[model samples]
Target: MSTDLPTRRAPNWLGAASAGLAVAAIVGEGFAIGIASDGGWGQATVLAWLVIVLTAAAFFGGLVATVVGLGRGAGMAAMVLGLVGNPLVLIWLLGALGTS
Candidate 1:
């Protein structure tokens, strides 16, 4: 007699969530840039906070998905986006602060 074992697949939702959050972070950063260009320090600061929060969420979510073996590619992409975006946001904030 021959027996077959079922293979387990990781949940795709985690990957999807991570990617979505990363995209949101990018959008938030764009808004922050616009606010900064307009010399709206208060608004820009608020938007910067939004960007930071979104990037953090994406990073943690991606890390969890990756460590859990759930959709490595999507998780890796999200993590990369978060890593790159976070530093850029910080630089923008620093420049804004210096100009103000």
Candidate 2:
């Protein structure tokens, strides 16, 4: 007699959420850049907070999905893209630009 194990897969919803949040992080970063370039501290502060939240969500969500092996590509992409939009990094770059 032959025995077989059932197939398992990570939740699709989690992967989708992670990918979506990652994209949002990128978009948020773009807005931050525009606002900072225009010297809009008021808007930039609010946007910084938003980007931080999005970055955190994207990174963690993608991590979970990647570990489970579902949507690995999307999860990895999210992690990379999320880091690219990190608010701390943005602050440093913006400061340097302002100084220069």
Can you give the TM-score per candidate against the true fold? 0.78, 0.72
lDDT of 1 by residue, 1-100 (tens): 7598888776778867898889888888888888899899899888888788888889888998888877778888888888778845668878988994
Local distance difference test, per candidate? 0.82, 0.82
Error of 2 at 25 (Å): 1.4
- Candidate 2 Cα outliers beyond 4 Å, as residue runs: 1-10, 90-100
lDDT of 1 at 15: 68
Worst 10 residues of 1 by lDDT: 83-92
Decoy 2 TM-score against native = 0.72
